[model samples]
Target: MASKESDAVRRHWATNRKAAEENRQDGDQELADHRWAELTTEPADVDYLAVPGRRAQWIVPHGAAADRALLCLHGGGFVGGSQYSHRKLFAHLARAVGVRALVFDYPLAPDHPHPAQVDDAVDTYRWLLDQGIAPEHILFTGDSAGGGLTITTQLRARSVGLPLPAGAMPFSPWVDFEATGASYDENRDRDAFFHRDLVRGLAWIFLGPDGSPRDPFVNPLYGDLTGLGPIYIQVGGDEVLLDDAQQLAAGAEKAGVEVELDVFPEMQHTFQMAAGRAPEADDAIRRMGRFARRVLELETR
Candidate 1:
């Protein structure tokens, strides 16, 4: 049975789904983004600074290490979401891991398509390198579409001869743009915020008419997964994207990469968003923190 708090989260997200559906019907993306920002609770101990040359922010938790960093990407189905909407969630993760985090806004769909987001992510990563952060000390993470970005960015870095990060942590990643996973059908009624129609629409907007859904950069499940560092993936068992996480883990393992995937029963997508308030979320973040510590060689707090 799900905990009471977890049930509360489900109810909360159910309400959010209603609002999101209405917003989708009304085509009010701006309002939807505003509501997302409003729903997140910023941590009191984390400080943020806007990056001068990039659409990114540095989320520095108190006493965090200067040498280690997590480059975080926000999830909004590749159409919505921004730095403001995801700052708090990344801040919580950074705080738990005892490291600074860089959360950035990448180009969205309809206005900007496939390679645009890839270009922006690569640019921001280069900017991080230029700032004197070593590739081995860095980590990457994201939720939903942003989770997919985490994997693609590493591939992009490898393609460009740039050093890859020490590890990656993706939460409920939406990697299969074709929506071919069995979970899409099995979890159809269980998942609150995602469905075939909605993801299909976002896929079209993100991939554009000319792009292929299986393009490794667009759907990382089809990408070469060898040689990337340790990866930790977390997914809600009830999410429609559950199979994306499973397939990614299996693919990475087959490629001889170290990987771990955890699925929380009855949890919703990105349940880590409730960190500090929900026990399940807190436990998930702690696990991620331990993974960061091990991979980045950070001293135990």
Candidate 2:
């Protein structure tokens, strides 16, 4: 039931899988950006910015709320992805929510692994607080591996005594480092890329020699989920990670946290990357905006 534009996501992953299998993958840069570049119409209403001392870039939509921020940790299997690759995607979200967005970057795997990405995300978040953006006014958001980080980073920050943000919005999140989610098996043939082999390999690289894939800190599937902010999750129903979102929502709910999980049937992974070019993607963004606005206590117009 996906629209014609959905083909962009399919083609994007197909090309990535082809290159990866051939061992000719160009560090995953082109293929990763291709999803956003090919599917997203540039959001013309936002101004992109870089603070000299920060590890992130800002996508400030015109008339954005001065005190609110959406901190985006983009997805690239923890190996590759950056603000440059994700700016427009985040910009679209920022514009929808009427707030500024920070597209954060961290060192990639095999070069910087494990706690490194978590540390970077925490540091950027604290820096946002230091810059006068209130913790209650912020939301953590991202896709794929970044979506997983949106959860893990909050756990790390809480361990170090930082106040939790207003909420988190994670879509197509890759949270089950063990890849134990049944959706992986169910959607294996449905998903052209991200087979168990590829995902498990990424998990090992992300964990590094000192980390453990099953450790709650790294995987979060076994971690305590208490005291976190409300969570809103979106996942392509066709994704191998579908159960990741389901299990995470169930875990958060069991922990007494608020959870809203929206599954887009027959959609490809990170299909929200198709925002502005696809109705399904736009609908997803609208839901995120509503959740963020309500959680942040912004007056809904």
Candidate 3:
């Protein structure tokens, strides 16, 4: 029942899982440092900002003004990952779309739960506003679990009467914490880096005893997304998160939000990270860059 392309991606992930596990045990701080080092070769016009309660980094395109900004959220479930791991990718994204990226160091779960990550995301937007960036000129982007957080934060922003962002992009988002998506089973054998069981295990850890895996913050597809900004979700047809992406796309459309769902036939989750080594990866990133460029141009007009 698995396509050849999907099967190949699964093989790649199976081979890479050991490395992912090692990185997990090594801790986010260590992984972030290593990822940052790898990104030194593709440096951005970097700047730092010290928020009263948190810190953030700005990756701007060279020779470009900071007229537009994308508040980036990096994913490592809810307890792992940091801005460092995503520095090069964000820098490239900033340059590719000719916009600045404001990557934040949001607090993780167990230590900070449910609303913490959500609140931190809202706080990052506020930080952007305080620095003179208009809310209409800002967008939000994230991957995997961070993708869910990005949407959750947007909801929280609305509840608190905060200004809405211009648009959003969630790459292979882990949107359905309940893990009931058809792709969870359909693509189980096809996906490489992530499987339903692996996600559930980590989700349980992050949610703790008091946390409900079904909570909208943890599972955004169940939430009300009405009146939200334009959203583009990219997912691999072979990914276990394929269902999460699909369900969210449907939910967003039902809520009347402008939504675009891109299902790449043979790709895997986070393939863009492997772009330098994979042609499919390059194509995916280019597609995303083009999408973001369109959004940016529309916002400017």
Candidate 4:
């Protein structure tokens, strides 16, 4: 159960989220880009790499042996989001798991369109394998659209006989881009932000005319899931993406994948961002850190 302090923080974050979203409504892309840029840091612990295909960059955290590398994807409706936006979250994962992470920049839709993001994800994984990173030592992580990318990449990798990663973690993933789920409508008011209309708008822009919004690459739950590795996901009870999390879990179970899921009630999307003050956020981060550690340990052994 969450504590009273955590409850308060949740409320505060919810209130602040509304304000922030409204304030930056006109500058969504700019805000996301700025967040992506924030990933650059000092101490030289996490090295950055610029790879081919969609301005891809990797974040390598120090302390852990360089052998283990995490491929992280950032979320922004497949049009926005980058490594910089997820600095704190990924850095915490690196420090806690004692491993380096590579935050890849996948191509966004509308401009780059479908197959581009998935292709970039596959290329990045291949790059990791080429660098001699063992399949069992690599893990995939992402949030929102990036979360979708993580799963789609896994599917594509498996189809091509690429070595699967040790495990995968996706937080509040948008699994069904087709918007066929009921929660997409029901959770609109429950979640502080993330309305159905907005998601659909973004979807139309990203998927383009040639793309089938329901295609498994765009909507992971619609694909075949057999023979995938262990997986875990985190989501808030109030987020519009809630159905995506639940349905994905069910699909993973049907596919015979070892899957673990954590759901926090009354919480909003990616609440872990408020970790400094929000107890819920702090607890979620701790949970994610612990999950990463366990996955890496089990895979390494």
Candidate 3 C-alpha error for residue 20, in Å: 7.7
Candidate 3 per-residue lDDT, tens place, 1-301, comes to 3333334445545755767677645455775556533522354464444335566777767764577788899877887777777767677666667777888778877788766788778877877888898877788888888888779888888888888888888988887766777787788777776777778777877777788877776677667888888898888777898888888889999999999998887777765555444556556667767777677674355
lDDT of 1 at 221: 69
> What is the Cα-based lDDT of residue 179 in candidate 1?
86
Clashes of 4: 3
Return the clash pairs for model 2, or none.
Answer: none
Candidate 1 lDDT, 1-301, residue by residue in tens: 5566666557656877797677845377666666655544668788999888778899999999999999998898888888887888889889988999999889988899888887789888888888999999999999999999899999987899899999899998989888888999999999987888878888999988798998888887678988999999999999999999999999999999999999999898888777767788888989998899889998644
Off by over 4 Å in 1: 7-9, 19-31
Task: Give the per-residue lDDT of model 4 (tens digit) for 205-245.
Answer: 88888888778888877788887888889998888889889
Q: Candidate 4: minimum summed lDDT over ten consecutive residues — where?
A: 35-44
TM-score of each candidate? 0.94, 0.96, 0.86, 0.84
lDDT of each prediction vs. the true structure?
0.86, 0.87, 0.74, 0.75
What does candidate 2's lDDT look like per residue over 1-301, in tens digits? 8899877888888887897899985755666565456667888878988878766788999999988899999988988878888788889999889999988779889889888998999999999899898999999999999999999999999999999998899999988888888888899888868888889999999888888887776776678889889999999988998999999999999999999999999888899988888889999999999888888888754
TM-score of model 3 vs. true structure: 0.86
Candidate 1 clashes: the total is 0
Clashes per candidate (backbone, < 3 Å):
0, 0, 0, 3
After superposing candidate 4, which stretches have Cα over 4 Å from the reference?
1-31, 35-58, 298-301
Specify the highest-TM-score model's number: 2
